[model samples]
Target: MLGNVADVAQKEAVAALQKALQSGDVEGAGKAWQQVINSISDKVKTDCEMYNTNQKVLAQRGYRMLTTEETEFYQKLVKAEKESNARQAFTDLITTNGGMPETIIEDVYRELTEEHPLLNKITFQNVKYLTRWILNDHTKQSAAWGNINDEIKQQITSGFKEIEVTLYKLSAYAVIPQDMLDLGPTYLDNYIRTILKEALYVALEKAIICGSGKNEPIGLNRDIHEGVDFNSSTGYPEKTPIKVTSFMPKEYGPVVAKLATTESGRLRTFDEVLLICNQIDYLTKIMPATTVMTAAGTYAKDLFPFPTEVVRSNEVKTGQAILCLPEEYFMGIGGNKDGNIEKDDSTKFIEDARVYKIKMHGNGRPWDNTVAIVLDISALDPAYFVVRNDADVLTA
Candidate 1:
């Protein structure tokens, strides 16, 4: 399957370069040159993997393998082929871009992103794995509906609300010495991948907690306004903030079980619920064993409900945890409708570098309050999805 993809990519890249040259379009030719190099690099990696697998299988079947001299010769052949391709790609790029290193760099950056006409590895594409996502065509007002009920001639009562969709711009850059371009495609590929990964991680971390209406995603912690209170013994006012107190593992089970019950008198199931907490809390408290005994066992690890996921960030406090249905979190990415890479090279005059910027537009918020249950460590017996002054036991 991968071999077929590589073949098609190689053919298309050659055709694109030829067409650009015939039209006397140097920028387009540079882009085509980069595409050819990228495609061949992918193919070479795939071929290397296949070669290793075949060699292993042949040895397992008691077949005679190539001698050390023959093996080294084959490896050298592969290296030469890759280097030959890289040299051609760089030569073509320099010729098309008038031998201006800066111009060639800009074209390479553009091709690596939106202009490549393939799956982009430079952006935060993995956000889809963490939240329910929708692609919006433009920045505009949108709407999401809530659950509806059926009754005899009953009219709908506020079943939907308006949601403003906004886009956030995230940008980062890496400075590469001009001498590094001569090191071949492998070095360039690794350099680009490293910078892009760093940029994506920054965007993802902010998306997880940035407040809404500030040109950022409405994060999970920001959307949750209520939680179980643990201040009954202190007699603090209802809306007053409380300090966290540690609890034993045996006490974790009962408190977690009580969280499954909703105010609607429905027993919320824990089949799809996930406990999100910091790594420190999970290692030192949540998963630890306790001395308390019950019908099932004496350890809290045996009784705690649902699987746990650690978010390696300080946003989740040391003694706090969140119980949530991940499906209820909605994240929508917009912009880049024309699939074009935006670039800025003004920094070259001052810092001898080019800044490649990709504008990412997205917003996120909870689909429903009930699906997000915030649990304060001080108050474990009760959990809250909605803040209520009268229900002081569950409001924090």
Candidate 2:
């Protein structure tokens, strides 16, 4: 009767711990106490029993039950509870930091919604359920599927894997409204872009690394041992290299000659190129222009539609302070059949060719103290090519 009473009391303690840990709205060490208790109940007794059994079986091998080890493991629960309190404190600090409350919320939204097109299809209820699961930081591996779709479940599983890393980088400052209070966009453009770009890169890298046959426990001889190799078989020759030449007046030879060497053994993809270009441009925005810029697009014109170069000669030489020329003067050297600069004939094709004659008026020049003259110069077929237009800027 006494043993049964002890067992009943122990079970009650375990249940209480589990219930406390599983509470929906406990703060600080209160929530952690439950987790610590539950952990102790689940593993400590089992480990103790196992240790005791092993000691009995291996008495000749100097095996002895270490009550101290079990006690130490139990003590870790206390440490874990303390850590939980630390987390709550950190969360409180974020709240009191005088920045954005929605920073974390927006981060959660971006992580859950952006990049994954599935977010568009999933219902709000399922999303909330998933969000709640995320908040709980629990797994459904032991549970039933419930009503969530297989696709959404798969996404949620995958997304959950990265939650730790995502949370580490996503700061509360991102969601804070710097300008208008509570009237700004839900997510900042910079933050959204940052998350999307990182997520996209991660997905791409994972796809490349975890491709078929690579996941075998013992990696044997297989194709794609290295990522650089692409099959040139089946009548597909290697893509031709792109050559870019700088614009030069017949007298002073071109100073720049740029080329993107096919990364040997690397199968080039349109999407990969596009991503590289976007990343390069984003970095370039923060840096000064160098003599030869390594960018993603085909030509200078592609980087900045209708690029131009100017000549400045001192009065002692030509007596002209500056000679301004429209960007059109410097033609895209290696023009495709349709006059548009080629961006890999292998994947994306360029067809339409229309010339724009933009005027430039600037300071300390033949055209001094002025702005650029925007002009659409030339008559050409616009059917084949898509014009890159800036809606904010005026066009002729």
Candidate 3:
């Protein structure tokens, strides 16, 4: 119970710190961060004092709850990452300690999905290194009543695409200030995780939506059927945006319905769909069009002809929205282990800080061209409260 309480407090402090930093309240941020660090320290101290006799064992293991000399040694290691002799000393220490603990890759994935809504929506596969992604191209192949005829079996055809996930590499860097080492590994983990979350979130979501398929993952905005005889584009084809004059059910429903079938004309089952748009467009266009006054004298939003969840992003362009069945998109990302966090360079950032680089192997793409529709909501009409007295009528 106490551990759970401490976790809640630490989370609250971290949230407060984020709020302060986002609002540019430096003083508030400092205070909130101090609280977060205090919570971390308290937790470490509590764990150390749990058995009282186990403190010595934990200290001998050097698991964050270090003595003053051990603390100084850690500081030395951080500074020495730039120096050959210091790095060698630390490397020898690790070699003697039997290397690093292998952290479960799924835990890292859990942190990302738990924090971001869009990440949780699509398919997230934590695949092994160099794993080949076998995608059955959503092609329709229904079993016939009596498949005894060899000619009938020959007529039925299906296709699958093989993707080499090793071709995709996601690299990101996080800057760690020298002062942060005072908080120990507990807080440092949180800091680096926070940095990685935001950085990876922006990069991954952008690529999944409209990334140029040159060296990156192909996205929803591109035609997924380039190799077919119907599509002439050699490279990933750029999809022509379907125009929309308004967000009325009659105007938008048909366009969205067109995305309900596979490239092979198979129907996809869905209860909820996703609407991804530029942050500005979401506020200026989507919200204004979807929001309506309720009978209880309140406002309800995102009310569409279909069950739709809107995702806002700054990466997408203005006047455009991508609507799709999110389940039709597959994203696979994982790495060897989180145990090998290394210094980006054997140098300092000159700001009493250093940058650490993490390597991730990943790939992503929509299942087919039927997965999403690029929409032009540039001229979407802002709904107004209308008054009427007939049965099932709009009222102010």
Candidate 4:
């Protein structure tokens, strides 16, 4: 993986630079710099190719792909991060606060259960496993060192509350809707909101399980977070419980959804969603929403093999069409730092053409009733109250 490769390269680069600076090898250092730059360029090209290949694999596997809005927002995020020094800030916080990730995990769970019953059902035992699951180390069967020491748990828990707002703000970068992060001040509240975002996402997946009609007889029920669930009673006879099968390295779920928004009015059409999934590039004249939705529609007809009900009708107003895309899609992902894509290269590689689109929906009813996408532009633009006062969640 690129992350692992980058870690190794970073170590070598630092060592070489340190040596050059110490030895005063001006000429040798210059050559080293060129070598490193070439290596980086090659890596970047390979990374792009890998990304493209992943897209092809997704297509072959019949999975939904990121929308154009998602692709663009992610690109913008990467670009913006390159311009900032916040990466170290985040790293320092995580490291200084007791490097054990469990502290955050426990506190996150505590806040979730206390405020949200749906999450309250999630016990500590299962949560430890879930953490491991996220780490992609499912083989960790036991939370060894069995007893949950109160002191350790408390310290870890403390870290969770302290970073709640930071986590929430960070999640804004994950492309989650800003409305969801509106819990009032206080570490507990912030923590609660952060937990709610993930819990609700799980809720959504549960809905998909019910909607897929695969788990049990699809049934309707109220989820803990107040989301309606389509469970066994609703219809499917053989669907597995909806759960996150994989933890995205960083939150990309919501940001992927935002990629469909475009224009001043920020309108999106069904076709645009489809075009984005297919990776078809078109002139700027082509509305992104139209391109994406059109492609998705065609793909759905041939690829959607299961029984699922997605409302599709031309009679729906443009506003309604725009509304069809999940609100979560408008949220942005954060805490992403490029791990040096082009570290070294002697061969040419593919470069991806990415597009980003932001659409603001002003409820126009109340001045504050506006929906904005905060892709990767953390540097605030205060002229517009909506733009200025908004959280540093989405940019592009």
Task: Go through the candidates in order and give the clash count of each.
Answer: 0, 9, 0, 69
List lDDT for all candidates, in order.
0.44, 0.24, 0.65, 0.27
lDDT of 1 by residue, 1-396 (tens): 876787689668756765564466889976875575456546545554554457564334222344454334334322533464643443343344223222222333343444321112213232411233443212233344555663445344443445444456555434443333443343334344434433443344434533333555554554333353324233211222222333334544554564465433345565544555555665655544212333343333323333443333334556666655555566454433322123344564375433334344455655533444555654333221222344454563
Cα lDDT of model 2 by residue, 1-396, tens digit:
432453455445433433342343245324343333333233323333344345454333222233443334323322322454643433333234321232332343345444333222112211211111222212233334656555443334421322111000111101111121111121122222232233222222222111122211000011222243443342111122122222123211121111111113222111111101112222322011212222332223223212323211110011111111211011000101121111111221132211111111100100111111111111211122223445523553
Select the stronger candidate by TM-score from 1 and 4.
Answer: 1
Arrange candidates by lDDT, highest first: which order?
3, 1, 4, 2
Clashing residue pairs, candidate 1?
none
Reference-based TM-score of each model: 0.44, 0.15, 0.69, 0.19
lDDT agreement of model 2 with the native = 0.24
Q: Please tell me which predicted candidate would have the highest TM-score against the true structure.
A: 3
TM-score, candidate number 1: 0.44
lDDT of 3 by residue, 205-295 (tens): 7677776665667788888674633233344766778888776778777887898778877776778789988777988899888887765
lDDT of 2 at 156: 41
Residue 54 lDDT, candidate 4, scale 0-100: 68
The prediction achieving the highest lDDT against the true structure is: 3
lDDT of 4 by residue, 1-396 (tens): 763575367346534643463366877755554444334433333444454446565344222334444334333334333445534533343344322223333444454446433223222222111111121111112222536554433222111101011111111111212222221112112222232334333322233212222331111111211133535544322212222111132332443344344322243433312111101111211122122223223311211112112322111112211112232121111221221011111122122211111111100000011112212211212121112222333442
**Candidate 3 lDDT:** 0.65
